[model samples]
Target: MKRYTDADTYDNKIPSVVTIGTFDGVHIGHKKIIEQLVEAAMQNNLESVILTFFPHPRMVLQKDTNIKLINTIDERIQILEKTGLDNLVIHPFTKAFSRLSAGEYVEKMLVEKLNVRHVIIGYDHRFGRNRNSNIIDLASYGIQNDFTVEEISKQDIDNVAVSSTKIREALLDGDITKANVYLGYNFMLTGKIVRGKELGRTLEYPTANLHIKENYKLIPKKGVYIVKSEIENKTCYGMMNIGNNPTVNGTHQTIETHFFDASFNLYDRKIQIEMLKRIRDEKKFDSVEDLKMAMQQDENFSREYINSIL
Candidate 1:
C-alpha cells in the first residue's frame, strides 16, 4: 500500500473511496469496515484511502498524557497494510489542524486534497473543532461538495465500540484469549533485547530482557504469559513474565522471556512477541529453590498449552 505522511501533498490523481478514524487496534469490527471500504472502492473503480492521525487527537487536544494505546503508529500501519488498502495517510494531529471548521475539513482535506468520491464512516462519527460535526453534517457537506457519504450501520458502530473497549479491558486484565478474539489476532509486544541482572541464568532459565521504547503502547497486566516469537526466522514458544521480581528482591518491573530449548544470544536484537495466553499471576517465592520450582512448573504448563494448540 502507498503511504503518505503529508496531507497537504496528498494529490491522488485517481478518485478515492475514503474512511477516516484512529483505527487503533484494527480489531475485527474495524476489519469489517475496511473490508466494506475495499469492496466499495473496487465496485466504484476508485482508490481506497485510509486517513488516520498520529499523536491521537485526544492526546494532543485534551492533553491526555496517561492514555495508553494498543498499537504504536508503526504497528498500526503494519497491521493496516494487510487489509489491501490502496493508500494510507498518516496525518499529524496538531492543535491548529484540530481548529479547522467542519466545512473547511470537508472541502480542503476530503474533496480537494484526497479527491474523495465517497466516504465510509460510522453513524456517530464527528469531526471539526470540538467535534461540532456529526454524520448528518458530513452527509450535508458531501452533498454540497459533490461526494457521497455512506453511514455504516449503528449496530456495526456499537460493535466496534464494544469490541475496542473489551479488547483494552481484557488486555489490561490479562485475558489474552478474550482480547485476541475481539482483535482477530494475538496482541504483540515489540522491543529490543536488553541486559538484565542475569538472574534467570542462575536458575538455569536464561532469558532475554525486552526493552520497549514506545511509552504509549499498553503493556499487559503484570503476570506470566505464554508467548511466541520468530528468532532467526524460526518460530519459538516461550513463557514471559511481566513484573518486578519479588523473589529476587528486584524493584523495577521487567519483561523477561525464557525460550524453551533456545540458547542463542539475542542482545540488542529487535523482536516481536505475540502473547497467546495468560499463564498465572506473578508471585513472590520464599526462596530461590521455591522460585526455581515454580518456574519449572510454569514452563511445563506453557509447553503443554502450546502443544495442545498445535
Candidate 2:
C-alpha cells in the first residue's frame, strides 16, 4: 500500500473509492468496513483509499489530552498496511483545518485531492465548521462535486462505536482476552527499550524496560501479563509487568518484560510486544523474597499456558 503523509501529498491519476475516519483500533468492525471498501474499489475499478487524522480531533479541538488511543499513528499504519488498501493518507488535524466549510472539504480534499469517485462514510458522521454537516450534507456535496456517497449503515456504525468503546475499556481494565476478541488480533505495545534501575537483575529476572513515546497510547491496567515479541526474527514468549514496584517503593509506572529464554542487547532498541493473557494484578508483597516467589509462580503459570497453546 502507498502511504501519503497528508491528502495534499497525494497526486492520484486513478479515481478512488474512499473511507474517512480515525480508525483507531482497526478492530473487527472497522475491518468489516475496510473489506467492503476494498470490494467496492475492486468491483468499480477504483483505488481504495483511507483518509485518517493524527493528534485526534478531540485532542486538537477540545484540548482533551486524557483521551488514549488503541494504536499510535505508526502502529495504525502498520496494521492498515496488511489490509488490501491501495492508498493511505494521514492528514494533520488542526484548528485551521477544522474550520473548513463542508463544501470546501468535499471539493478539495475528497474530489480534487483524492480524486474520489465514491465515499464510504458513517451514517452519523459530522464534518465542516462547527460540526454542522452530516451524511445528508455529504451526499449533497457528493452530487455537486461529481462523486457518489455511500453511508455506512446505522447498525454497522453502532457496532463500530461499541467495539471501539469496549476495546478501550477492556484495555484499561486489563482484559486482554476480551479486547483481542473484538480486535481480531492481540493488543500490541510498541516502543523503545529504555534504561530502568536494573532492579530486576538482582531478582534474577532481568527485564527490558519499554518506554512508549506517544503519550496518547492506551496502557493496560497495572498487572502482569503473558506476552510475545519478535526479536531478531525469533518469536519469544515472556511475562510482562506494567506497574510501579510497590515493594521496592518505586513511584513511577513502568513496562518491564523478562523473556523466558531469549537473550540479546535490548537497550535503546525498539520492539513490539503483543499481550496474550492477563496473569495477575501487581501486588505489594511483604518482602523482596515474597515478590520474587510471586514472580516465580507467574513464570510457571505463563510457561504452562504457553505450552498449552503450543
TM-score of each: 0.98, 0.99
Winning candidate number (lDDT): 2
Write down the lDDT that model 1 would get.
Answer: 0.93
lDDT of each: 0.93, 0.95
Query: Candidate 1 clash total?
Result: 0
Clash pairs for candidate 2? none
Over 214-241, each residue of candidate 1 has an lDDT whose tens digit, in order, gives 8889999999999999998889999999
Choose the strongest candidate by TM-score: 2
**For residue 105, what is the lDDT in candidate 1?**
91
> Candidate 2: lDDT over CA atoms?
0.95
List per-candidate RMSD values in Å: 1.0, 0.7
Error of 2 at 93 (Å): 0.8
RMSD (CA, angstroms), candidate 2: 0.7
Tens digit per residue, CA lDDT, model 2, 100-184:
9988888879988999999999989998888899999999988887889998999999999999999999998999999999999
